[model samples]
Target chain A: MASLYLIGIGPGSMDNLTGLAVKKLNESSVIIGYKYYINLIRPILKNKEIIESEITNEVDRAERAVLEVLNGKTVSLVSSGDSGIYGMAGLALEIISKKNIDIDVHVIPGISALNSAAALLGSPIMNDFCSISLSTNLTPWNIIEKRIMNAAEADFVIIFYNPKSMRRQNGIVNAMEIIKRYRNESTPVGIVKNAYRDGQEVILTDIKSMDYNTIDMFSTVIIGNSQTYLYKDFMITPRGYSKKYEY
Target chain B: MASLYLIGIGPGSMDNLTGLAVKKLNESSVIIGYKYYINLIRPILKNKEIIESEITNEVDRAERAVLEVLNGKTVSLVSSGDSGIYGMAGLALEIISKKNIDIDVHVIPGISALNSAAALLGSPIMNDFCSISLSTNLTPWNIIEKRIMNAAEADFVIIFYNPKSMRRQNGIVNAMEIIKRYRNESTPVGIVKNAYRDGQEVILTDIKSMDYNTIDMFSTVIIGNSQTYLYKDFMITPRGYSKKYEY
Candidate 1:
């Protein structure tokens, strides 16, 4: 039974990898992923053939993984976070569909960056939340701006992925400006960089105090909704629990 | 050391549980959770004290877990999915904050219902997405409606948690109507019931064809964005990859 396993290794930490993900990795003889992601799970890569690709080469990597499965191999394509969310699963499935390949594709989910960052920041996304990526390499900035404005207006806890890059520094600044129109300047914000991995940094700030320069592609930025508050260095969006219950 | 571990057990399956969550559960002297969620991991509950509570008693549950920690007993509070997302993490943190308790709270992230449902539905949330719980238990219907409309207007892949319950049945219908205003009637929708658990059910339908009667609190419904399409039973929302690359 040849198959392709799209596994989320979970925010660059082997401890965050699920038992099922580890089992699939052990079952497969070959594992493919981005170079840094491969390094994150190197402890489990013993005696396994590894294919590491560079960033921005997603299509090539997904195509190669699909081709390996087509060639009667049990292949694993690993991603840093949940494979289904902004990871390799979608690209691999699309390639399989377009090429008319007959094979099993199992998406084994893991702790996404969103989940890991939220945990590190102390439950900043316990309510209705939306995740928007600020990378304009694929998505246009106009659409991203609209999402920021809409998310703020709806009063949803908002998570920003790829908030800043070396070349695209102004996206976060522009997005913040749009969101500030709807949210208060004192709303709590959490910035988590390299969550669950080495040099992990967690910063609790507010809309008016967050330094955009500290954010990069690796940072996950969560802006609290109107009711969100900061208590004792922890950022929390209440999930409206306080509105109805006494704790 | 006395500490409280807020752990997400990853949607009712031991196989989905991360190694860190299991280690924390092992380190704790007392494990607390809702009855159903506790039963999901009963296999590992051997020789461990378990406190099972009824539904709608979240404040009581969180308080007990916090008190156990304050009494110098290591405690683990488990949730079905990621604790930071509509789970026990926020409630426990708030209790700790308001009481001014000096305790270490470690949030172990897990595969949330959104992640598990998206994986079962085959990358339906690969693009920008928002999760809104239709449970009016704590959140008002009007607020939920506004979130749904804004999510639709922003063209985001939308995930509905607690889509329906025994007492409330009309939220799903009203939400679908609002979403249809911005999306096409033929937009792909994926419904996953009891994901990764026993007797799991997965259905792929369109906005117009989805049976609202079949949904309940145990179900997670994913409505795709404008660019989403179904490929041989798999619902996928492209991450603007095809617009820039060829496979």
Candidate 2:
């Protein structure tokens, strides 16, 4: 009866690792993750066998992680942002469900990329907004396009994750094009580079002025719908109170 | 010059508190928070003078938190949800901007009611969603109505904070009416009771079946817009996928 702990260690900071999460990490006999995440928590691993895999091999990583846990090792798998968001929890559980394994799995939620991004950008997420990943790894392009269109049409404040990567990166451009397909071009867009990490940079731009090429694997982009506004050095996606409050 | 640390202590779980948040909390000498939240973290506080205040006395709490810092006590004003999100940071800064206070005010981020509610109900917030508080105490209904209309029209998943209290409870029905004004009556809804607490209960319903009377101070109600669907065991809001993926 091996148990697997799928933990979401809040965005990058070491202190973000909850005391419970750190305890769970210390309890694990083997730890599996992408190389960077493994290295991030290496100091506290405490005699746990570490399996550091590449980012692209998430499915492979899960398969190996499951096999190890099934072999009676207390296993802990990690992801940077909350595990459920873009992490491997869904896929892992899906695999477990398929295998009919009765193993117990625990998911520890971490601070997601957007939450950190939103924090760095000074609360653009304070209003009503939605988050979408521009990655088509498991999700398709046409659906992503429609989601973007629907979100923009819904006048949602948008937070985009997985904006771009090395090989397949034009999703941001297509996403913006779909957003502009329904929303006004004058909307404000805020970008967080390496959010919650050292050398974190924040840039505010307009919807039409977005430079797709400048955004890479480390950036999170937030686009405000038509009703979103800025005041006193904060970007606000007003949920319609500006006119009513003025009086 | 005295410095104020605006730390973002995550949701109720100690694991949710980040390393940065701990450093800030420990560095402060005086802590001010609503009674409920103060009770949660009282055991962890060390060398700090704690000020437990009720929710209604926010301005007074903020004033005292700032005043103590101004009086040379390293002060920390804590908010349960993200400090800046519909909480004290904005108002405190506004008051500080109006006065000549000599202390530095730091706004620490805490997990907002949104993520805490979402975690209880599996993946209702998966793709894109926005939150709007229907409370008229600080915001006018006209703005609330427009935001609801915009969010409903946008088909973004919606989470309502402070849905109903003793006096302003009418806002929930008004919000439902406004949402129904722009959306279908069959959209799925989820109400989380005492989210993250011991007696946590999640009720999955729809716009047609929602009743505002069941909600009170301890509950967090999440209403999914047009695209949100109700599964038997889970409240599934489509990120526009799930059809393509073989389940």
Return the top candidate by DockQ: 1
lDDT of 1 by residue, A1-247 (tens): 9889999999987889999999999999889989999999998889998999998789888988888887888999998899998898998888877777778989999899899999998989999999999999889989998898899999999999989888999888999999888998999999999998888999999999999877988999999999888887689888777788876
Model 2 ranges with Cα > 4 A deviation = A66-72, A96-101, A140-156, A168-170, A174-188, A205-213, A224-247, B63-73, B96-106, B140-155, B170-189, B203-214, B223-247
Error of 2 at B112 (Å): 2.9
List the candidate 1 regions with Cα displacement exceeding 4 Å: none
How many Å off is the CA of B205 in candidate 1? Answer: 0.3
Q: Which pairs clash in model 1?
A: none
Cα misplacement distance, residue A23 of candidate 2 (Å): 3.0
lDDT of 1 by residue, B69-151 (tens): 88999999999999999999999988888778889888999899999999998899888999999999989888999999999
Per-residue lDDT of model 2, residues A8-84, tens digit only = 67676776566657877888888899998877777787777989999877778778888998889888888887765
Q: Tell me the deviation in Å of residue A205 in model 2.
A: 4.4
